[model samples]
Target: MSGAIEFWFDFSSSYAYFAAKRIDALGARVGRPVLWRPFMLGTAFRETGARGLSTTPLKKDYARHDWARLARAGGFDFRLPEGHPLIALAATRAFYAIDEDSPAEAARFARAVFERYYIEGLDTTSARAMGDFAAGLGLDGDRIAAACESAAIKDKARVMSESAVARGVFGSPWFFVDDEPFWGHDRMAMMEDWIRTGGW
Candidate 1:
């Protein structure tokens, strides 16, 4: 069987948010399924000793401007929440829990969470917020929120992050088309080409 396009990303990453908006379509065009894998960016930052764009001095401002430009160019709504780069642990865990039963639903839930944070300018860092997002999608909000605290879900999330780092994923919106890796939202076009031509 053909390998799926693995989309490893942080739920709090704006670049990942932009990528999330288009990745499914990219997968469709290439005749591959998208495996939406949500991991903790803080774990990656800790391992790589890198700071978030919002925390970095000069890059923060530039990133904000870039995000605005990308949003305008892509024709999507985007606004930095009050507490930018909020912890996405709860949401990530909830995604894994839901994914255990339904991957498509989990992807749907992840998109909703991204929209709530980036487009609606709301908080999705808390379990309650995650539950609300899940409930909005006709899921069991309480079960999902409760799963955030489960040992199994926590371990699953931790392992996923560790696996991502081990696989050389140092940034958000990282993609792996088979064994080849692509980083950043801007690399999506290059990734598409690589997939189309079966790599150069």
Candidate 2:
């Protein structure tokens, strides 16, 4: 990949969670750097008139079975954390804080929040949980916690959500090779092929 691939994700989306763990390998194969951008799905949905997965019985049912299939196919241990819907705006903004510190590690930190709420049945909105999650990533716990509460980061998240709207993104795990957007993990292979053949 001569340029870069943008991966826009939301922490609470099951598909985004799955893609994050595997897209890096796909990028490596194509010789491209993955530019991870975390955004709020709720904002995107509000603007685009899309609904959350949990609210859609058909999609939610499909996801329920699909997640099990994915776990087996990908050889990753899978467990649905809880039934509570996650509000990811704060956590998504927190990603920008840890991003420059370490992109790979930052992704892990964001994923930790995902796992905590989605897989471990933990209440991530708790101040204590956020601090503990930050500490686990070797980040300054207090600083990260404070940053999450900052108006600046909150604004930053709003910007990212608007940016996604501008980019015509309506969902999570959206990948872009330049302006060409790929919307699902299944398209990851095509992303790799595009990179190897020199970006389209």
Candidate 3:
């Protein structure tokens, strides 16, 4: 099989939400599988001393406008959740826990979580929210919520975030085509080109 496209993203990232909607199809078009890896963007911020797009000064306003434009162009509904830049630790942990058992379900759960926050304007930052979403998908929500608090899952999430930083990932929607790193949702076109041409 061809190498999977490593899609590193944060649940709280609006741009990452956009990438999630399109990435899987991109992978299908190229005969490559998409590996959705959710990591804590907070860890990256701590390491890089960077603020989130929603929290940054002038950029935050620009981002809001850009997000709307992107939504219109993509024909997807999008709205910032009540509290922008939510703490996604619970969601990330739950994702890894579920992923261990079923990758496809985990990906579906991830999309649902993103929709809950970005589309429905709901809070998805808590374990309860994660459970609710999981239950809606016919998974064992209670068990998933309990797993989020497990030391093993917590450690797994932390290690994944650290690994992302180690791999030079500093932003949501980061992608790796082989060893080359591409950051930001806007880079998806370039990523497609790279995949089609086998790099320049």
lDDT score of residue 11 within candidate 3: 92
- Pairs of residues clashing in candidate 2: 81-118, 81-119
lDDT of 2 at 145: 74
| Candidate 3: C-alpha RMSD after superposition | 1.1
| lDDT per residue as tens, model 2, 17-103 | 789778778778766788888888887888878898778879988887998899789887667765546676557766776775777
> lDDT of model 2 at residue 183?
89
For each of the candidates, the C-alpha root-mean-square deviation to the true structure, in angstroms, is: 1.1, 2.2, 1.1
| lDDT agreement of model 1 with the native | 0.91
Candidate 2 or 1, higher TM-score = 1
Candidate 3 per-residue C-alpha lDDT over 81-136 given as tens digits, one digit per residue, 9 for 90 to 100: 77788898999999998999998888898988888889887666778778878988
Better of 2 and 3 by TM-score: 3
The estimated TM-scores of all candidates read 0.97, 0.89, 0.97
Instruction: Give the Cα-based TM-score of candidate 2 against the true structure.
Output: 0.89
* Candidate 3: regions farther than 4 A off: none
Candidate 3 clashing pairs? none
lDDT of 2: 0.76
